[model samples]
Target: MRIGVVTFPGSLDDRDAGRAVRVAGGEAVALWHGDADLHGVDAVVLPGGFSYGDYLRCGAIARFAPVMQPLVDAARGGLPVLGICNGFQTLCESHLLPGALIRNDHRKFVCRDQRLRVESTATAWTSGYEQGQEIVVPLKNGEGGFVADQRTLDELEAEGRVVVRYLDDNPNGSYRDIAGITNARGNVVGLMPHPEHAVESLTGPTTDGLGFFTSVLEGLIRA
Candidate 1:
């Protein structure tokens, strides 16, 4: 499988995302923000970073990049897309996923290893995880609080669209402790934690995150 990792100006984790893809036994394709083409990748990842210096709002400017136009259309058509941290902000700005990420309730930047429970394994990105499985990955962000209207939140909960929920503690005051979510179609996923950072035991706190990458590959095989 070929996974395209997008790199916008100021993107810090694009390379790490690509390495994670390779570690998952998939070919990594480099995609630039200025380019509109997807390079025929089977999947796409919007990696984390302070895009456009987080001007105005995190991911607000990066969402308007040329690459995102095609990504938005492709994702709507069932192309699997994973957005991490700042990428999650971009996904929200693009309206690919519901809810918005705001400043942490504590009003400070937070960085730590966070525990998360797998809420739903129905999405392409999460099919590798068992329901209710607990895993730890790095979470770092200032505006990581996820917020949505009450009705929307209810719908998400009712439909099992909430894919992952924080365990023990809410890192950034996300609504209902939601750490990640999938689009209605289950093709797009957005989360604030850095799964790519936890893919290797030698470099990270745990290897639990490798499941996310491997799970997508398994989904592709089943397809």
Candidate 2:
């Protein structure tokens, strides 16, 4: 499988995401924000970073990039897509996913090894994790709080779209301690934690995050 990892102007983890894909035994294709072509990648990942310096909003400007148009269309067509950190913000700004990420409740940048519970394994990005399993991954963000209207939140809960929940403690004050969420179809996912950073045992806190990349590969194989 070939997975495309997009690199925006200030993307910090695009390479890490690509490495994770390769480590999971898939080919990694580099994609650019200004390009409209997806290069026929089977899946796509929007890595974390301060796109356009995070000026207008975390991902407000990025959603307007030329590449996003095709990405949005493909995601709607059931193509697997994963967005991490600022990428998650972009996904919300693009309206591909519900809810928004706001300033951390503490109004500070936080970086730590965060524990997360796998709430649902139905998504292409999380099928490798057992439901209700707890795993630790690296999380670092300034505006990582997730918020949505009561109706939307309830809808997500009712549909089992809450893919991962913060465990032990809520690091960013996300509503219902949500660390990650999936679209209704389970093809697109937006997560605040940086799973790419935890895919390698030599550098990361644990290899737990590798499950996410591997899960997508497994899903592709089954399809």
Candidate 3:
């Protein structure tokens, strides 16, 4: 399977995401932020970084990139998309996902090996994980706190759309310890942690993150 990783102006982990895709046995296609086409890839990853230097807001400027217009439309049509950290912020800013990522409640950047529990495996990016399974991955960000209205939060809970939840401590003070969420259709996912960083044990804290990439490939094959 082919997976595209988008590189925005300040995308620091785009290469890492591509490597993760290759490690998971898929072709990694490099996509640029200004490009208007998706190159016919089956799936896409918006890797983490300070897009547009995080000006205005974490993902405000990058949301307007030409690539994102097609991405948003494709995502709406059930194309699998995963947004990590700043990419999650971009998804929210683009209105592809609900909730906003605000400054950390502690007002500091956090970088650590965080434990997350797989809450729902119903999404394209999480089918390789078992429900309630705990995995450790790198989490790093300044504006990583997830915030949404109470009603929206309740709906997400009721619908089982909360994909990952922080284990042990709430690193960024995200609401209800939500580390990641999937869209209602389950094709799009957004998370504050860096799953791409944990796909290889040689370079990461664990290889647990590889499940995400593999899951997408498996989901596509099943489709």
Candidate 4:
């Protein structure tokens, strides 16, 4: 499988995402934000980082990049899309996923190893994890808080769209301690944590994040 990792002007983890894909035994394709092509990648990942310096909201401006148009359409057509941190913000901004990301409730940028519960274990990006399993990965962001209206949150919860939940403690004050969520179709997923950052044992965080990338590969195989 060939996974495309998009790199916006200031994307901080594009390379790491690609490396993670390669490490997972998949081909990693570098995709430029300004280009409209997807380069025939089977899946796409929007990695973390401050794009366009985060000037007009976390991912508002980055969502308008030319490369994202095809992704929007493909995502709607059931192509797997995973967004981490800034990428998650972009996915929300693009309306591919529900809810909004706001400033952390503590009003500060946070960075640390975060424990997350695999709530759904069924999304295209999370199938490698067992349901209710806990995994630790690095999370860093300012606008990482996830919020949605009561009805929307209820629907997501009731329908099993809430993919991952914060375990132990809520690091970003996301509603219902949601760490990640999936679209109704289960093809598009977005989360605040950087799984790509924790793929290797040498990394400080646990190597549990490799599950995410490997999960997507399995998703493609099953498709």
How high a TM-score does candidate 2 get?
0.99
Q: lDDT tens string, model 4, 27-139?
A: 99999999999988999999999999998799999999999999899999998999999999999999999999999999988989999888988788888899999989998
Residue clash pairs of candidate 4: none
lDDT of each candidate versus the true structure: 0.94, 0.95, 0.95, 0.93
Residue 34 local lDDT, model 3: 94
CA RMSD, predictions in order: 0.7, 0.6, 0.6, 0.8
At residue 195, candidate 2 shows an lDDT of 89
Better of 1 and 3 by lDDT: 3
TM-score of each: 0.99, 0.99, 0.99, 0.98
Give the per-residue lDDT of model 3 (tens digit) for 95-213.
Answer: 99999999999999999999999999999999999999999999999999999999999999999999999998899889999999999999999999888999887999999999999
| Ten contiguous residues minimizing lDDT sum, candidate 2 | 164-173
Clashing pairs in 2: none
Better of 3 and 4 by TM-score: 3
Q: Encode model 1's per-residue lDDT on 172-220: one tens digit a residue.
A: 8999999999999999999999999999989999988888888888888
Q: Residue 128 error for model 2, in Å?
A: 0.9
Ranking by lDDT: 2, 3, 1, 4
- Clashes found in each candidate (C-alpha, N, C closer than 3 A): 0, 0, 0, 0
Q: Can you give the lDDT of residue 150 in candidate 3?
A: 100
Residue-pair clash count for candidate 1 = 0
